[model samples]
Target: MADSTNQSTVVAFIHTYRPDGRLDSYMSELVDAFVRCGIRLHLVITNHIVPNLDSTALKKHISEQRLIEYINDVDPEFIFTTNRGGITKGIMEKTHAPILTWMVDHTPFFHHGGGPEDLFCEKDHCIISSLRHVKVFESTYPVLKGRVHYLPFATKVEDFKTSRNVVQDVDISFVGTYFHSGILENLYNYYADSPETIQGLLRLAGKIQSDPDTDILPLIEAYGIRKVLEDFNYNHIYLKWLFVNYISLNQRIKVLDAVSDLGLRLYGTDNWLHVGAYSLNLLGCFQFQKKIDTRQKLVELYQRSRIGLNISHHQAGGGLPYRIFDLLASNALLVTNARKDSDLFHLFGEDVQVPMYKNEQDLRKIVIYYLENEKERRELVQYCNRLVDRGFSFEDRVRSFFEIAGCRLKETGHGQLVKVDPDSFIRGLVRYLYRCGGNKPYSSQEKAAPAGGDRIKKIYHRYATGKQRLFIARQVVPLIPNGIIDMLRKQ
Candidate 1:
């Protein structure tokens, strides 16, 4: 760990080649936090991501040799990268400073040839976004037990703090890519080439989707497909990636179909035409806009939207998404799909902080109800904003990260410790809930409620009443005799 008394510089390895801007956003917030803590940052840009970024701290390195020379010249106390891929093993072996890797991917399968264990040394530390990845590392490679940590996704709240001058022009909006081009076709061709293997894979996927609560690893083993994945003989990782995309794409289409009557706008790539031949025609029912590449435009869209939708890829394995935090920070009413083992119910009330649905019908009902009930929607927006503001800020996340990694900060006469507050206590309760309940609660009462009893009760009552009406409309009405219900409906 870096000493608090010593002045230190940290080198950050970044790849900005991708146009998604996710890495750019993360690096910007992290750099800001490090600067605030009095730590100097030297950015090492790789892969020719950007020809030039207007910053004196940035240095572009096109090869591993150059990167190593730069690191040696800087002699920084700590080295940071977003993932293992950002820094090569050769570079890691040459550097004596501690390398802190914050990984956002599902698993380090890309490092399969070198073995995931080779990425870390005694001086290295890893921070993963998914808890599942943490467990996999600890269990698969015991050497990384004490060094691995779990940190959820967060956003810079200040960046999203916008004036309420914009009108809520969009009733609901979804911003993501629709995978249809090369990867999808390749996956289909692979499956067609291997009928038996694909059949087994589909069977396993079907079982996992049917009961998401089941441990997929055990099921994969039982299906005897574990060896195929482990062999790495074929494109198993790519296959899994495509599978996740397929699941997410299907879910997004279902959501669009369910709420086609509403003003649902889609902002993403043009690949959505592969969903169906008539997908282009379906755009008539809802607005279809091209992808918004910049963060400013995205924040503007969120600010102008009444509701923001989040649909996680099935491979997330109950991990809370970055979009959830972004939506909360934007003060947009969030209606998302409920994860089978999510800690969201603990951090925020089931329906108060954010409304989550279990199925397509439930999602439609919740969206309609929230849209019609402006007061409830506004309250949810306020509650989520307050909760996110209290603890889920980018600064808070970075501070917690330093503490977890045992890196100390210098005393600038403002000696403040980042500790858990009342809001943090609510967030901490999520870990407890996951441990005790195995993230499976039979009923709403079984889930942990927040501090104020009266407020919770009032929120629950309002949510239950509206849900009951939706239930009667969808469930009860279908069961009633058609003649009598039709006559009653006519009256």
Candidate 2:
């Protein structure tokens, strides 16, 4: 056990890299929250531990040895990481600290070899994002029966609100990767050699799509295709992976393609361009104009968009994506696909009515109706926002995480803390605007601005296109950076 007397509860955060830095951002936010709770975060970047080497055996041995020594030296109360990719069985065996592995995505079977040399130790625990996955994980791995927990995606309550009135110039917005179509295509092409197997897989995909709440394993097996399973040496996990990937991509493509004509402004990677290559109906509707650079920028985009779209990944059958909460927090009129037995309805209850679509045509109709009916959309947005404010933020998740991990806070905090009041910031900005002869009260177009460093720019840009754009540019644009002002001019 760690020193309980005068020491803060140290957490060894295993920081692995993601191309878009989504997981890294989650870690950074959680670390900040835990820091406030007096947990001393010890960041261990995976790349630094083991270099990319040719010899797999040598690399594994070195990383295991290095990690063993490092864990012993740090003597953290527990090890916390997402996906458990960098963690090994040897490290788990050697360490006294309990490992809290947060599975943000589906449990990959590759992490656990076909044999018993899996990552699980008696003391280690799993925290999955989806409640449905939590149930599935426990049932699949009976050994980890009591060790799994459900902690859904959340946003910072304080940061994701509209305190300052701003205009929502954009109509529809989506912020997520289109996912890797090439990989799925290749898998399909491989089976293309076997027409029967390809057709079977497609039929299996349709079954899974229709009945999403049911496990994919059973669906695959029920399809009665021994060749598909036999081809992968009876690796059900890998097969499930391929089918779910296909279903999720299919769902996103279908829905996005349906709603593409309605001034849809996508914000994500260039992988969206491949949508057209995949389907003729898509016609590059998934093409993203801007890459949302930061969390703040994402919130701003949601805030500025009249409607924020959430297309659930196929795996998320009974659970809502974190984007649902973010869109609600940003006060975007959200339009999402209906999940079978979704956590959304149970979480919010019957009081709030969030728009959900059953199919592509339904989604298009819902989106169009919401766009035309402003009062009803805004009313629903307010209701959802209130529910989110009640308890659905990252702060709430941090507390839940600590309780589940059995970590207690120390009497006094160690890190330097700085606090900024949004109301105060808004007042100051309003005063500045007043000096610039913009004595007009909040306009019809402007709604509250979500918290961010570029908030001033969002406010400036809202009125930038209006009659006041030139006046504000002369007055406030001088204070903002030239580059930022130039960008705002384009908006």
What TM-score against the true fold does each predicted structure earn? 0.70, 0.74
Residue-wise C-alpha lDDT for candidate 1, range 29-116, written one tens digit per residue: 6666766766656664432322232121111212334456666666766777665544656566887777777766553423212444
RMSD of 2: 18.0
All-Cα superposition RMSD per candidate: 25.6, 18.0
For 101-135, candidate 2 gives per-residue lDDT tens digits of: 87766744233234223546677788877776777
Assess candidate 2 and give its lDDT.
0.63
In candidate 1, stretches whose alpha carbon ends up further than 4 angstroms from where it belongs are 1-7, 20-27, 49-63, 109-113, 131-133, 190-194, 207-239, 276-289, 346-352, 410-491
Candidate lDDT scores, in order, read 0.59, 0.63
Per-model clash counts, in order, read 0, 3
Q: How displaced is residue 432 in candidate 1, in Å?
A: 60
- The positional error of residue 448 in candidate 1, measured at the CA in angstroms, is 62
